[model samples]
Target: MTLEQARAALAAARRVAVLTGAGVSAESGIPTFRNAQTGHWARFRPEDLASPEAYRRDPKMVWEWYAGRYRNVTHAQPNEGHHLLAWLERDKGDGFFLATQNVDGLHARAGSERLVELHGNLSTARCEACGTVAPLPEPNTFTPPPTCPVCGARMRPNIVWFGEFLPELALEAATRAFEKADVALIVGTSGQVYPAAGLALETRRAGGVVIEVNPDETELTPYMSYSVRDVASRGLAALMGEG
Candidate 1:
């Protein structure tokens, strides 16, 4: 569909749900977990550093890796796509809900209030033992594994690690949004990831329209009512009539 058509659809929809992925943050210079700079340990697959077993076997390594990620994310600013989503949320009043698999916290930074961070966030730390949550200390000087001040338990980045479940509350919210939305805008995702990818199907099953924006055709393209081959920043701005 043309940009005008997409905008019209968005404007007419009563309830809209958005699902975003790493590509949405890439425009802001955030390196995805799979594409870290060469020669850095982060260049290794995220699965190697993001798992309960990994933290249990070598807590220091896990903490250092997450610290590096937190530093990188902190240095990056939210891109235009993030602002567009936030603007849509504000302008749409109660009709918009955003669910993202990225842990960068860019959505919140961009002022999107009704958002679910499905993968948790790197800006917070959680106690593995007591389930206590707190903002991670600034500068993250702890070597290797960090200790939680409240419970003296090992503090892990609040993100969902490999083999771990997504936060139940966030998942439930996302599911409800998908089930009730009249339009579902999927941006910047490969549509191969579980749960997040399933949202499009849920929307479709609920008789909602699916609009997908990606640089390439993802697995969900066949299921989309509208498909735009563009980055989220460009596509979403166009859809919101700001382009």
Candidate 2:
């Protein structure tokens, strides 16, 4: 009944918004931030590599850590969940808005264009001086601490660090979309993370239906119009299947 209800709402709705989390990318074998720390990396805390202070202390170490992660995502292929969202964007066209907390860039690889990566992507780097965003050198040729071509300044992984806030433009656009959406899908997130997690509420507050798709119940489950109980691919398949 829950799945049917969500399917009905989505089928009829033209303005749709979606928010994806780490679980979507994890389905493709990309480990979570903590899960990536193994072997030699097991000794360091997350704050040591992901915070601005950590970068200031040792930019080399920080870039090394990110470089490994970049390789991991670069090698990964988009899964069924990613393809589903991308297909959804093609259907909705101007009415679709997809936002993701995951920085793996799988959504983009899956062909989702009208999307916002709430966090930064690992496939690219941002210059420290000119703030120019550019793709990383090819995986084999890449080295840590890349320099900018525009201003000749040091480049850092284009990621949102622990102490830093999300990019204002992305957040604002997502908020606007969520507020105006006719249906909002919150997929594969624990809802423990703030601001991004709060996006579902924006849908409900604006009289839009909010649906959750996850294998387990999250904090946001109780408030949703319906919650599909499964992982991202299977859960989304159930919601969208045969409809």
Candidate 3:
């Protein structure tokens, strides 16, 4: 469908569900996890740094790596794509639900209220033993292998590690949104990740219209009713009649 058609569909739809990925934040200069710099983190694969085994073996190294990422995301501002979604939520009210695979807090910073963060946020830290969670400490300084003051157990960034399950609440929320949506707008994701990728299919299976916005064809392309091969920020803006 054309941009005009998409806009009309969006304007007329009662329930819309949106899913985003790293490509959305890439516009804001946040490096994708797989694209870490060759000099510093290239030596250590993301899988190595983002696993329970790695944290168990060398928590300090994992902490240091995540600390750098946290700092980067804290410094980067949300881009047009984030603001566009926020605006959609503000104008469309409860009919719109957004779920993101990005760990950066860009969607929150952009003022998206009804959002589901499937990958978990990078701005929070949690105690491993007691499950006490808190915003990352000030001065952002953590003694390598940080310890929780509340329980004296190790502190780790509250993210879903490689081998970890996606947060149950987030998964449930996204699934519910998918099941209820009349239109599902999937953006920026390659649609390769399990569960998140499964959303597009779920929506289609439930008889919802699926619209995909990305710069390239994704695994969801075949299932989409409309595939717009363009930058997400631009495509979404156009689709929302803001361009």
Q: Cα-based RMSD of the predictions, in order?
A: 1.8, 1.0, 1.6
Report residue 89 deviation for candidate 2 (angstroms): 0.8
Give the alpha-carbon lDDT of every model: 0.86, 0.91, 0.85
Query: Best to worst by lDDT, what's the order?
Result: 2, 1, 3
- Cα lDDT tens digits, model 1, 204-227, are 999988899898998989999898
Name the lDDT value of residue 200 in candidate 3: 88
The lowest-lDDT stretch of 10 consecutive residues in candidate 2 is: 1-10
Model 3 segments beyond 4 Å from truth? 139-146
Instruction: Report how far residue 109 has shifted in candidate 1, in Å.
Output: 0.5
Number of the top-ranking candidate, with TM-score as the measure: 2
What does the lDDT come to for candidate 1? 0.86
lDDT of 1 at 48: 75
Reference-based lDDT, residue 73, model 2:
89
